[model samples]
Target: MCYNATTSATAFTISVLCSIYLIYSGNKTHNNVDIFAGIATFMIGLMQLLEYVLWKNQDCNWINKYASMSIPVVLYLQIIVFHIANKYLYNATSPTYDNVYIIMNILFAIYVICLLVWLSDQKLCSKPSANSCRLVWAPFEKLLNYKYGSYNVGWVLLLLGFLFYIQFGIPLNGLFYLQRSFSVHKHNYPIRNIFPYITIIAALVYTIVTDGKRMSDTFGSMWCFLCVSYGIVSIMHI
Candidate 1:
């Protein structure tokens, strides 16, 4: 296993708790964003638990399948969280609804469709092997001990998501517009930007560092530590 079962299990438990709270809060406030965040958190928690179980069973092939499937979900959810947070923070109501957001949703859906098609083409999802899905990005390809991997398109999606996030927070005129618009909203801009970025960065760093080295256990331990810390902060926020 790339990570410890106990650590993953603990993180999973924390995630489940955080998700429950988010769902309750979302329902109470009628906030769709909070509900999405709750769902994302639950998915991540479930993935971690599933990974733990597969690891316990010594099923590397299934681990590969799970990671391949889950990473995109995580990345997409990160985008959603950031975009929603950006909308709330800036209060930038576009003249008509947010066409950009709609476009992004459509694009993301298309991208997922393409990804599934690619997965089918490679037969990675149907096949069973430890490294069959290994067609990833430049560094991640190396990190996962494969020359290539199945998530080449995922890297593109993640980049697009991040770009959209920055754009949402600071539109074409950029941070200057953001500052000017804040005057109208009057709500203190809580550092809501930090969470999604931190989560993405931590997940990326953990993936790269843990998989790129022979002594992955050491890095995996730190990854678990970071996940725990993030979970604690998330609960406090909820």
Candidate 2:
């Protein structure tokens, strides 16, 4: 099955509870990163629940398509926001921080527009079928489409954002702050430093695997699982 009801239900429940707790406590803490992370987590759980429901109905194209693609944008936002929040926690504000946040927001907006256009142009079907179902193309073909060059622009922005995130957010801010927050023996600083790189590597490997077989359900599931699991872990650290 494309979406297992049992598993999705369980995920949905846990995600909802997490969302409530994170939002409530995040407000108390006055942390934007945790707030956004909580929002992203809530969305993830909502998306999983929607996927489960839509899988049975099969006629809800717009909602399903948009929900699926919009996830990455929020996921990226959560990470960037986390970086800013972490900096606030440490009182390590930089002059360029606002500029970085603005740039990232612009890029995120561009990506969202591009993805929405791509999804809206899709050839949707009421029922899932080999010829009608476009699951594989959703991530590969649709996302990569260069019509109007928005896709290219989106990718450029995303790549630049990734570099900035790693440069300012992950290696310097994230690693240092996390190390300070947790004891040396309790937290593996080196591993934490490498986590972002690991995620990038995993994305590259998944892209290669998907390129070989776009329609492979197993590969897609594995990719989604890794990404979602990693996202959850990242949020927990916030």
Q: Which pairs of residues collide in candidate 2?
A: none
In model 1, the runs with Cα more than 4 Å from the true position are: 22-40, 43-46, 53-67, 77-97, 123-193, 198-227
Question: Taking the tens digit of each residue's C-alpha lDDT, what string does model 1 give over 110-213?
Answer: 76556545443342221212342212221222223322455545445545644654454221112433444445543322343245455445555766776744
My TM-score estimates for the predictions, one after another, are: 0.51, 0.54
- Give the TM-score comparing model 2 with the true structure, all chains together: 0.54
Task: Estimate the overall C-alpha local distance difference test score of candidate 2.
Answer: 0.50
Off by over 4 Å in 2: 17-47, 60-62, 65-69, 76-84, 87-92, 124-140, 145-200, 209-238
Question: Using alpha carbons, what is the TM-score of model 1?
Answer: 0.51
Tens-place lDDT digits, model 2, residues 73-98: 54455556566555554455446655
Maximum-lDDT candidate = 2
